[model samples]
Target: MMNRHQLPDTLLMGYAAGALPEAFNVVIATHVSLSDEARARLAAFEAVGGAVLDDDAAEMAEDSFDRMMARLDMLPQANARVTEAAEGIFPAPLADYVHRDGRSIRWRSIGAGVKQAILRTDGRASVRLLRIPAGQAVPDHGHRGTELTLVLQGAFFDGNKRYGRGDIEVANEETEHTPIAEAGEDCICLAATDAPLRFKSLIPRLAQPFFRI
Candidate 1:
């Protein structure tokens, strides 16, 4: 059970309808894998969608089958054992995007003991994994668009709230926060942003373009 933050029904519905950007979908998929509550909620949405489709006598386009077949070719194979928990922290879905686990990632440092590995995604949005050392704070910033952050390991505090593993924080232009990883362990999070962030300070702003943050 996710105690603090859970994926909103709106986002879960969007994910069910296959309307979200691929990067966001990745984050949602991984979160669903980790949280039983999220998985159940997502399943409800999918069931609703399925019932709706069944009740509607919709005509399929002549090319629909061909298009679906093409899409299936692009998706994961039905028999692949890629969604289960790995020996490392990464679950199957995330590992499919990255690799087997943390060791497979080639981390890039961005100063202040923070490191990140940008995941390959479509140009519509960008996603990455952030490793914040214990007790260190990410630079204060606002969002230009939607941002989805999921804690994978350890914990962090932002806006007087604590987010631990499986907790997802959703932020938009109206949200601004400085997230600090808690002590005792490093915090690892998978973050997806639709647009670049709004930095409050000069150094991070200056370095933003270089990091493609």
Candidate 2:
């Protein structure tokens, strides 16, 4: 029952094909864990991929069959439980990375009643959790590359739209807006970015290097 927003079709397809960067994959996987509709859509893409493979005309080597079976045996079981470390707020895929209760998260202050915890990710892109107090506003900024942000709890309004739990905001260099958490509750978001943000304010621009936002 997703009510606010959904991942874009391009992102969904890239995730299904395993072609996204590690940071992007993490965001997609976590969103899928929370949205049954996303899961079904991803399954459809996988089915189409399988059908295409079945129609492949190239002949396989004699040892290919045995090697494939051996590889299957080496793969971990799909039903293995994610760690019990995370509170229910985190979906299982994200829980695997945090590996601790939400309250235990070490948050770093980023001014203006906002806090953040950077999550270790592969390559140039980065993933992190952000907590913004109710009514607080994130600095007005645009993206240098791409940014995918998923709301895990509460809500925020970014001038153009309101995003609540399970909503994802996809932004690129062309987009810039000040996101303000709604009045009643703090907004918790899982965000991934491929490059440094483009800040408008002089103070934010100066602090950008130190905060790595």
Candidate 3:
């Protein structure tokens, strides 16, 4: 079961409606793989989707609900096998995203606790793939522009908020906070930023130029 604050209803609805990015969808898929209650909720979301498809008055464009249903039907049924398969596929969910050929990631280590892969850059803003080990602290920093983070695996705590898989966090230049990874698992996140991160301390300041994230 998902904890009370685990995944927001908006994200769950997006996942069920097939409206999320592929990377974030993979995380929601993994969560549903782990929880029967969440899976049932997803099923409810699909039912709502069916209702949308049945709405004749809307006259929307092709929603591809049938295609999505076909894919859902193909998903494995055995519980053990489903869990194993989802776990196996977790690490490489971005395979298709990376293979599109136009985008690439440049991995660089910024601190003892973190390593980052610069996934794409438009000269101004950039996207990154980041991993911070269990119990490690991400530097207290703010952004020069906007920063949007999607949690792909594990959990992290910042201030009073605890973000888990499939959560999308939007932070801006005005948001300055430090986060610590939970004790049991590493925190892996996809971060998109429009400008350089502003380091808050001497350590990050010294490492900023050499850091890739």
Name the candidate that leads on TM-score.
Answer: 1
Q: CA lDDT of 155 in candidate 3?
A: 82
RMSD of each: 5.0, 4.0, 8.2
**Residues 44-147 of candidate 1: C-alpha lDDT, one tens digit per residue:** 99999999889969779999999998898678657766345756777778888887353578889877899999988777999999999999999998988889
Q: What ranking of all candidate models by TM-score puts the best one first?
A: 1, 2, 3
Candidate 2 lDDT, 1-213, residue by residue in tens: 122477777788888888888889889988887789899999988887789888869879999999999899788777566444356788878877776454467789877788999887787688999999999999898888888989999999987689988889888878877889999989999999999887888887887899988
Leading candidate by lDDT? 1
- Report model 1's TM-score to 2 decimal places: 0.85
Query: Which runs in model 2 stand beyond 4 Å of their true positions?
Result: 1-4, 57-87, 100-103
Q: lDDT of model 1 at residue 108?
A: 92
Q: Score candidate 2 by TM-score against the native.
A: 0.84
lDDT of 2: 0.84
lDDT of each: 0.88, 0.84, 0.68
**Deviating ranges (above 4 Å) for candidate 3:** 1-93, 99-107
- In model 2, pairs of residues that clash are none
Clashes of each: 0, 0, 0
